[model samples]
Target chain A: MSAVGSLVAGSLAFMAPLAPAAIGGLATEYVGALNIALEGLILVGAFSYAAAGSIAGPIVGFAAALLSSAIVAAGADLFSRKAKADPFVVGLGVNMLAPAAASILSQAVFDTKGVAVVAGLQSAMALPGLRYSDVASFAVAAAIIAAIAATPFGTRSRAAGMSRDSLAMAGVDYGRVRGAAYFVSGLACGATGAALAASVGAWVPNMSAGRGWIALVAVYLGGKRLGGTVAAVAMFSLLLSAAAAAQAVVELPAELLLSIPYFTAALVVIVGARGSARRSARRRAP
Target chain B: MRPGFRTRFHIETIHDAGGTKAAVRLVAALASAATLAALAAAFLSSEPSSALRAFFLAPFGTEAAFLSTLELAAPLAVCALGVIVSFRAGHYSLGGEGQAYAGSFAAALAAPVLYEALGPASVPLSILIGASAGALVAAPSAIGKRLAGADVLLTSILVSQGVIFAVDWAIGGPFRDRSSNLVAMEALPRGALLPRLAPPSTLTAASIVALAACLAAAFYFDRTRSGAAHDLYGRNQRFAELQGFDVARLSWAPIIAAGVLHGAAGAMMALGARGTAIRGMSGGIGWSAIGAALVAGSRPQALPFAAVLFAWLDSGSRQASILSDLPPDAGQAIKAVVILAVSARPAIAALRRRR
Candidate 1:
């Protein structure tokens, strides 16, 4: 029972860090834009958190990450909306630019290709007697999921997603709503990056390692529902943790095991076309 | 109606259409010329006169350096040409990096065994083997798209990363060269080396083959019905479907063609490097190819010029580092600036026209 509980909690904790990106994916579709720059946004957020944590406290680091990501998200929005560039291409260019910039700065500062440990950030801890950090992260994720599901803003965002012109007819500024949602989503992602950095006590280039895509898969698997997204993320995260732990007992290369989550996500997306039906049903429901 | 009148009407219409086409062509040529001049002026104003001279001419200052630059640009041009095909068909193949690596892996594996068995005959066989390996690795994404309605952009990217990690693991375990500490496979046999075109300059017959391939691609695009169909599909998929074109088949052709070219590039790189497959042997050429494709606006003929420009920057950066205090990374920065400039040009022009 204890082992099961721990496993469930661990999965939830892992899913928590993924929520912001899942939310960003959901929000992008709503705003008539594809948030393909999520990977780059996450990288920038991670680097910002690390840099700020090394200079200031963990709280400041988190704030810095949020600010930087919001700036980047805003820039992405401006380029896509005002410039009339292809969103997919521009998003890819943004993705390429981030890693190159990060690598150049990282090389200049640390004289290394990857990132170094930030000094001032607080690592995730068990709070003296209990494993509070993991539990708290899970709880925070759950609360955010519930809030988005229940809130008027979330409904409005969903409405915008379904049909931007219809939302505009209802006197909602679709662009502003999208811009705001993307900003908030980026902040959440930044905080998640900060948490990951704090928990691990170091950063590496490509540290997220397609986790942003996993979040995207979770969104699709969950049919863009708050509860379903959480459930999907938790399920995959558990698989990831189990795969990691299995490295000890199995002679197979860990890389092969690490591929399981991605393969699983792809399989789910392919086989479970039912998610689209559920989404349509939700649209028709009260 | 008489047949003579109908034929006369048809000739007149053709003549008028041809005239309009010639006028449009003339305008486009002028626009391109003006843009090139503007770019040159911008460069001249920003740098010292001597620096400007070196920037454009340094790569050609010596026969050896000029040849080496072409050799480096050849594989990049091939990969970029592949990217052009994929992009022209409206598919985002971000998997070129992985595909290239896959080909390299196959070539590296085949090199030693074939060299030992067949001596000098192993070279061409190894190249063919490598190209096939890349195509095989890339085939699944297209299959996934057709079967599952999966997004090629996402699936191809994930598969690319998976292939890279898998290759890394294989190198670390089964193919690990125990004699070396650098985590690379064993070196290829001497007989497997590609024939050099010029001694000590890395120029090889592979570069000539790549150039011929580029020209063939250009001809195919300009003079084929299927090529026109591809253009139509890229411009408007629903319209193409309405016109009774098989969208799936059209999309698949360009993607597979891209994979083949990228695979060929990998084989060429392995052959040129004398069968050594280092991690990152493609040296971000896939990404550079994407950049080149974007700059060329998915035109096969435009790829060589864009690729040469990139190669110039790469070589000029090294030259600049030796002659001045600027770092080699400065070249990378300049390349980034060029990408930003080109991507922004259309938007800037559109805004101006609007005003």
Candidate 2:
């Protein structure tokens, strides 16, 4: 493959892990409520993938991931809306809780501190023609984005997010819409977690690393638009791929080099946000 | 005209009613407690009685165990104190882990070098070097937030991951100790290590320092003018601003203070662990500190007691595994359950509200 093609392939693979965040962002943009617990949701999904992959098949593992994510998301939503707890705080708590739970489970079941290798799930394959699973994941993400953008529910969801009261006044049950959106977000997160494990062929504790947060950055950079979010993910993935590819040639430590993509993404978002805000202010001024 | 105006006002009243703040506080508290209870139950069932008993009581059963618990809690208490300050100021600095690691790395790098040059005086110097390194690492995130409106949480987390990876690379690569089988740097000289307060136990002078720091923080947070200003800013930034408080300046102070405490904790860990900075030597203490702060509801003075309780549970769990058939991991599961139950009390209350 050409250098560009290899980069693209690597980027696509990297983007697979980010699918959950993009999907969650799409839900928030549509539903008018943010799922602040995306990090926890991802963690739970990852653990569920590991656990279910160990006992049953990948299908069961996938189901477990989706179910676990939904439960966490729903719990977060319920707490935020009904209990009146801060979403951010509760989300942080959930993030802590997920890994601890996963670590304990791994240790109890497999006598491992961080991971468990389940051959059953590892052997799970994609449809024969697809060749690689990442291609399928990217395809699904694109489809979800396209479908959401083209739907009326999506339009209403975005409107609700902008102003819940305004949407409510228009006869939409904003709470119900938000609840549904969170469920969808959880499902997406779970799918991403399972896909990530499947791709790696093993489940490592805290495997999502900071990918969920990275996706959030991508969402911000993408301006919360589906196309833009996908583009941002693609851009970040490509950057990471390039860094990884250059590791052998560069004398720098791989870990420090691995940090380049994250640092670059954060810097780009910061700089871009400031510049755009300034440009808009200039345009608004006489 | 008057009737029409009155009818419009009545309609507006209904709209305003919808905006009435939900009883979220009561719900949050209940949900948290329920989650803790459930987790505790799960953990208790998963382990044998002896393990459960040991997990809960071993740290308090003997002096050595108690001191060891304190040794562990000291660093966590210091780190959590920093988290509480940052969180109170509405700044989520998740980079404590990273900052702590940077402090550890600096301490490790400096301990041997400083010991050779300064001889007996290297201990304090190594600590100072570690604190400075931690502060430097944390400064970028603080500046990013203050200058560019960047989210401190994201920046700090990113920086922390980068720093951790860098530290790991340093230990595994250039700084690799040829004599040891484990992946760690060269150990510091005997004089460089913190003086032990108790024989055979890991408790050291660093624990006393940590305790002093906590007491000092309590004074600063409760009685000092700047601390009061931080409290005001934290509770309501807009209100503080309206009251002519320098919310931004006051907020920055706490964040920097947090970095200092986290750095100190890192240094203490290095000293207590005998100079070598092991991977995850902080041992999820940063996260637990956050948990402790949350459990204490950001009351700085109450942190030590909470930290001790958490540390006790942590040590006891390990002891229980040794004494019983249950695995050591069961103890952590129990702790997680306790936290979950405490945090989930509000969710249950919310469910009640819905009904």
Per-model DockQ: 0.16, 0.36
The lDDT, on a scale of 0 to 1, for candidate 1 is: 0.65
How well is each residue in B1-355 modelled by candidate 1, as lDDT tens digits? Answer: 1100000001011111122232332233334433432353244234444444554567788888788788877888888887777766666667888788887878888987898899989888887887787777667666755555455565566677677777777767788788988777787766787777787677887778777877887777678877767767766788988988888897576777788778778877877854577665766677778766665555566666667667877777667546543334444545544554445535445534654
Tens-digit per-residue lDDT, A67-142, candidate 1: 8977887777766566555555556666666666666566555566576876656465664222332344344445
lDDT of 2 by residue, A24-98 (tens): 756765564434457767878877877877788777777788788877787667766664544555666676667
Clashes of each: 1, 30
Per-residue alpha-carbon lDDT of candidate 2 for residues B200-223, written as tens digits (9 for 90 to 100): 778888777777876887687678
Error of 1 at B312 (Å): 3.7
Give all candidates' CA lDDT scores.
Answer: 0.65, 0.68
TM-score of each: 0.82, 0.86
Model 2: residue A131 alpha-carbon error in angstroms = 5.8
Candidate 2, CAPRI quality class derived from DockQ: acceptable
* Sliding window of 10 residues with minimal summed lDDT for model 1 chain A: A128-137
